[model samples]
Target: CIWALVITLLGYVLCSALNPKASLQYTFTPGHPFATGVEIDYLEPIEWLPQSHDQDRTLGAFWKYLAIVLSFAAARDWLMGASRQERRSGDGASRFPGDRMQWLLWTLAINAAAVSLVGMLQRLDGTQQLLWTFTNHINGGHGAFGPFPYRSSGAQYLNLMWPVTMGFWWVLRRRNVARRSTSHRSGGDPHVLLLVLAALTAAGVVVANSRGGFLLLVGLLVAVFVLMMLWSKRQVGFKLGVLAAMLAVLGVGGWLGGEALMARFRSEDIGSMSGRKLIYEDAARMAEDFAVLGSGAETFAPLYYFYRKKDPAWNGYVHDDYLETRITFGTVGFVIILLIFLAVWLVPFVGNGIPAPPEFFLLIGVAMVGILIHAKFDLPFQIYSIHHQFVLLCAVLTSLKWQRG
Candidate 1:
């Protein structure tokens, strides 16, 4: 199944890249009758092998897609091979050998904490330059967060990390509790640092001042807390701890950027959808026109010029990743992409049962769900860093012992 999906995607992309350009032209009649008609030309739809309007861009995108797929496969194979070797050597009792997962979680947590702290400090300092050096003219530097020009992108990265940090803390806590039963002296709990980092990372998302990120972070935290309460054996202490952690996160976040966030919400543009509705409406028309084959890969910016309602500015992205996929990949390519997504997400659960701790799965699931939801309102998936993090997480999921109960 995996091979079939991969081959199909590869063929689709290769065909789109190599196929000759189409000569189809779309004529646009202005909404106002007094306005002159505009004629726009784009790639014609070919059922067998779709052609992109811009062959070079499509070819470039194909290379990127190929690299991501190969990298994911290589990473998954290496991790899984290591697990198999450990089991054969009879070196560990756990399904995953050598505390590698713990190391990975620790690294992610520490890095996220450091990045979150920097982003928060930057927000407070009111600097238009990213990293206090590279000035961003776009969005007038107001949207700068961390190293990213867009606050939402920074929020997305932090959002992905904090949940994993929480899961790591849970895993460590369980191991420490087990060790304490065998030996009284188990040193200070290292998991405390992870919990603190998780809270700090969550606070970073709030300080990012992205409305979508803020809302999603709150929803994820609430959902995670509820899940933890339901699954935990020791109810009262665990509940209190989780509640306190959540409060600290929210309180810190509020203290840092709550005023700015509130001001954004109070602003008239809060309900305006930031003109996304118009983009969606125009994109729908474009999709209908090229319903079979999309204009081309990475050609939305150029194609949008013909479909835009009133804005003359060159729109770079659809903002909504899913919608952009549909617009650029067309219905056929969209279905192929959809299948690939389903396979990536569902394949890890297809074997006997999940061998990793349920808490780890739950937390990673929260991170994945949060990012996917965020993609609907922003371009998180389009950003290479966020996309790479997502792929890495998926690879980690795939490498786990799904064949074990």
Candidate 2:
């Protein structure tokens, strides 16, 4: 929690520094990133025009680098800390926090509580006062972003993660049923609470109506169930039942709310599938034009505008994060990213023999699949939400290596 808070604070500091004070005081009017419909005085508390050169992503990249370094250092310490003792005794000493999964579960519990509170705030504001006021400007619907001037999609993106964490808590709760039964009945089942939280998150997701969040949730459930069934040494009947239950809970629930959840798929709306496709194609075309290192980091909008002037119907931001990365950083950047992904997925499976920390790997795998799949539709990288999830994963991975040593 402290680490997450630090990272978030750093991110806001970076954002404040990079965004011009004039721009930060007012809401950024939507138009072409390159060309302007009207240059209004920038007096909003948060302006989003410079998103193609997102200060947030830059700040997050710095944190990612730090996390990678910290993970390595932790592993090193874990390995070396007990080596002398092992040599003397011929038996290795296990670390206190040997169960990385437990730590991850705890972290998710904290995240669930935080996100739930935020979701409640969003629900209260949206249903009561902000609905008509925000709708007047947003035109497409707006959920809730904290204090930012723009009606951001980022908060909704964070909300998507609530389900994954809630799921983790659910699994942990079930695992603890034996212990809990011996203790106190009134303690109530954690799994039941998690399920309720997941339901509430579903409601929030439906209200947010993020195409990326919706698609990602679908992909996460399918991937998790299939992976578990394929990998687990469990009965076929048991696996099938688990799969069915997951589908019923997530898929069926989503379907019941499909009217609002799938609203983005209906028109040329802001959060629609068709809109994202348009941005993706443009980003691809821009990448081709810039070639080598593409347009440089944070230069996508300027480059996009340069291209758009020739064609007046252009808008900024390729909604697809992969395409956006390719366009902003070129093939080299794209390849580097792909290799990082290959390491994360393949390293554990190959070296560790099924990844001992089941819950950690499960959440990572789910989130990876979720983000990568969702990025094809929405650029989640622009926000601080997804990066925080990665940080939690890194922390778990670090603690795991510590225990192994």
Candidate 3:
């Protein structure tokens, strides 16, 4: 079923790319009265070919999307496929390896921590370039975070990670407690490291000083805490410990970037919606113009030029991913994408039971929730690395087996 959805999506994109009728012809004259200096003299008649205004970009994006989807499928098959040892078990049961998941979680958490550390240090040093190398004149060094010229993007990345790291710690703690119950022995707690890493990652989100990121981080932490308290079989001490850790994360994050965060909140743009209203208004006009077949994939930037009201600058994205999708893919393509999301998120829960530990699923769910909500207010999905990570998480979630835990 997932494959069917994928095939349908790919087919649609290919049709859009191959549409003969969907073309844009224009002429550019320097110092023209037009804001873009290019005047569109003709728009090829729209047909039912899934045509895009910019076939070249749509084709390029299609290939990249196909590659990402295929690669994820291949990697998932390799990881979840039955091994010789599982076959020899003779019960016809198979599960994804718990140790492998743990390793992956650890690696991801450590990497996030390192990136957060770098971003925090960069903010402290007030360097005028990213990594003390590449200059970003638009945002300047203070506004940049880690390697991302846009601090909000960096914050979005960290927001997606810290929750997963916390989930890792929760899984480890649960397993450790289970072991202690059976063995009557207590060993060194390795889960502490995960907690620390999660804290650092959360702090990174705050230090980046993205308003949306900060709010989402707070919401995620609160949700995690509430879920842990309600679902965990552990004692009051463990719950207290978790609460303390969360508070520490908030405290440290505030200390690191509280001044900047507060100043942003106090700024006048806070009430002005950061000029998103104008972009959204223009984007809505574009969507109405191409309500059916859409202008085409990867065509929003160019098509927006026609609909732009106040801003003459090139707007790459609609800021709202859903709105942009509606403008680019049209209602039909948007529905197809929605079906794909439903399949990915719902399939795992449709069988005998959840394929993996419920707690792990909870964590992954939280991560997805963050990005999905962020997409409503920002372009997290438009960014390749962030989009890839989201897809990877979905693939991982679907590939898990109930018997694995």
Q: Give me the displacement of residue 239 in model 3, in angstroms.
A: 1.1
**What lDDT does the true structure give each of the candidates?**
0.78, 0.49, 0.79
TM-scores of all predicted structures? 0.87, 0.61, 0.89
For model 3 the local lDDT of residue 283 reads 90
Residue-by-residue lDDT tens digits, candidate 3, 1-405? 888988998888888877734455546657453334334433464475687787778898899899889877875665565556556664765543344455566778898899899999998998758888987754423588888788888899998988888877777777767666533224247777788898888899899989999999999998888888888765786788788878888898899999999999899987646778889988988888878877778888767767888666667788899999998888989999989888887766664422566777788889889889999999998888788878877777777634333
Order of quality (lDDT) = 3, 1, 2
Error of 3 at 141 (Å): 6.0
Candidate 3 to native Cα RMSD, angstroms: 3.6
Off by over 4 Å in 2: 1-104, 120-167, 170-192, 226-259, 268-274, 309-316, 346-360, 398-405
Query: What is the per-residue lDDT of model 2 for residues 1-405, given as tens digits with 9 covering 90 to 100?
Result: 334434443343344335532221112446522234322233343443222233444444556546654664464344334445445764554542234344445556555445544544654455422422433223233444332212235334444465466446434543455365642245455444554454444444444445556555566666666665565454554365455555545554455445655565675555444455555555667868645443344445545654553334445567677777777555655665565555545444444322243554565556656666666665566554555555445444434431131
Between candidates 1 and 2, the TM-score winner: 1
Index of the highest-lDDT prediction: 3
Which one is best on TM-score? 3
